[model samples]
Target: MITRRLWLSAAAAVATTLIPGPAIAAEPLEVTAPTRVLGAIVAAEGGAAVVVRIDATLGPADLRVAGAVHSVAVSQRGLLDDPRNAPRVGAGVRKILSAVRPDLAATFEANHKAWTLTFVRKVLAWNARLAASPVRGKRIVDSFDRAALLAWAGAVVDPKGQPSPPALARAPKDAAASTLESYVAYVEALVRSLE
Candidate 1:
């Protein structure tokens, strides 16, 4: 009986190894290494400009699709003119973004609302982190910066005041895209401040 049992177990193992089952599951978008790394790069370094510049290069349809991915922010007053460094910064961000693009598409395709909120939370976390850190001129954010971030997040979720503008109102069909555009504008202004 033991011998029979051993033979059966071995046969089962062999069968399992030979038979094709299902594809391996993918990691969640928010927790994936590429997403986290991209977030860190954007938060730690002044990488939002790279995002904005990339957005500018996209055609209208592509830009709308990308809105479903993530938005970049900077503050105009805080922007510094460093044309010399733009190429280097764009290259690094492009490399990381290429890695992230597939996951972003899959996540948005799977659920657009979840994708929007995921990025909203990401920006909020960035805001909170910056707010908590000690301000060093444009290098870090403070309590004063939290309001805009909070308002942006709130507007995306509920669109009623909280610094609401008509453009960000949930328009049923185009809600996700519009929210993304609003997020991009907010981030662009914030990044300008940081730079």
Candidate 2:
């Protein structure tokens, strides 16, 4: 029953009162405030923000899960925001990856606390690695359910390696996004909104 706009407005208000620092980077993110909500598109500067309307609004029908991956087109963003020519994916963005992600629903069923813990850890790490940069604002143009999201994240970040900023940036270009990245983006929005 929560509208996205209302949730974001509340999140931004809460983010400003807290002290900011790199120490928070290592802690697991909890869904304590509207800022911690999983999906929110925002534009922020320093510690103030405005929620954006550019990320796609996906219904169950828009999602297609096959080939062990869920992919959506860039035009979806246009439908959510500007429906002009629509941004096109570059040829270099195409990359086929194997090794499917973990079944997040199954994981949650088995142990909701563990799943939440991993999600919190990954998201906070994602914020530290990316959102902490000068760019300030990072919006989610696309999304998938929890299982699909973890699956996509596992695909982009190697099992034997950690995520690199440059590599994380490329995932979205290839019609994929990391859930942790997007959630942290919500936090960034809160910061911007508060300032």
Candidate 3:
């Protein structure tokens, strides 16, 4: 008969291999990246003439999304005056936005604050308008995963003002996935514009 220790060791090894690693746990969804790009585009446009306000009532849990948006806008604006530097600045903005997705999702999942949903939707609608504009239309098309990002944004917000912690945690992950795609696209556009 096999020794108990040996059997247990074999089982543990199998479990280690079979169970997903942290990388897998952290393996950003494909959609997460593009969402960042979308957010960046909004920031780039909004930062051009205005600072989009996150609903002031936001608490800790809702801050991830709000904070990411704010950071993206600031970063994008920093690139404005320097045409040669815009690409690098845009890349940096994308990185910051993409990196925050998981944390944002975790916070949303934990809090599921209702007001957050309204805030996200408002932002989404505004973004959609920008995406539709002629001057910036190409930028949005080239950079964003429009439908997925919109859906993800919708999922994070709670329309009824009821708080739901589990849902909030999931929000950031989706947003991050979308952001990643958007970032890649934005970088590409920035590079093209430089040429």
Candidate 4:
């Protein structure tokens, strides 16, 4: 009999072969909120516990920012934390963002500079709260609402109609982007759990 590992490797290879190269090659494999939603769909198609790691990786901040940007509000943290909700939230955000800002899908992939300061500010503000909180077991899905999450992501991706000011003399140009990239990576990993 084939070992589980072997079966998985073979299955992955087959799957990769089945998906057209142009589809995979057309874009970088970065994970966005929409992609996470896609991952959630994949996970749902696969089975439960398929998204637990994704759920666990998300903190309240992600949900709040994603939710806010998407204009949806989920009140209960526990409900958001449920693996069942992962796909729903993910799919919902994808649909909403696609309708509202079709450009984001491409911009997020190519232009790091295009991400607005407002979006960064919102994410930073929310992260500050999470950092300050002493709660150990509390999760992102457990705390933040969909409205909050969408608001944060929207702020990051586009700061139009928001105020602007001169850059801080003391702040390095790349500091914010560097920090955000790290945070994005962390969140992306959670989204990947769905895959």
Clashes of each: 14, 8, 33, 23
So what's the TM-score on candidate 3? 0.22
TM-scores for all predictions: 0.24, 0.21, 0.22, 0.22
Pairs clashing within candidate 2: 47-191, 47-195, 48-192, 48-193, 48-195, 49-192, 49-193, 101-151
Arrange candidates by lDDT, descending: 3, 4, 1, 2
Give the alpha-carbon lDDT of every model: 0.34, 0.28, 0.35, 0.34
Per-residue lDDT over 16-47 for candidate 2, one digit per residue giving the tens place of the 0 to 100 score: 66756464332211111112121121111100
Give me the candidate number with maximum TM-score.
1
Rank the candidate models, highest TM-score first: 1, 3, 4, 2
lDDT of 4 by residue, 33-106 (tens): 22233333322222221221233354422422323423333344333322334334444434444344464444
Give candidate 2's error at residue 150 in angstroms.
Answer: 20
The parts of candidate 2 lying over 4 Å away from their true place are 1-108, 137-195
Q: Tell me which of candidates 2 and 3 scores higher on TM-score.
A: 3
Better of 1 and 3 by TM-score: 1
The TM-score of predicted model 4 comes to 0.22
lDDT tens per residue, model 1, 35-118: 221233232222222232223333211212233443332222112111112233323433344456553433323333334345
Which candidate number maximizes lDDT? 3
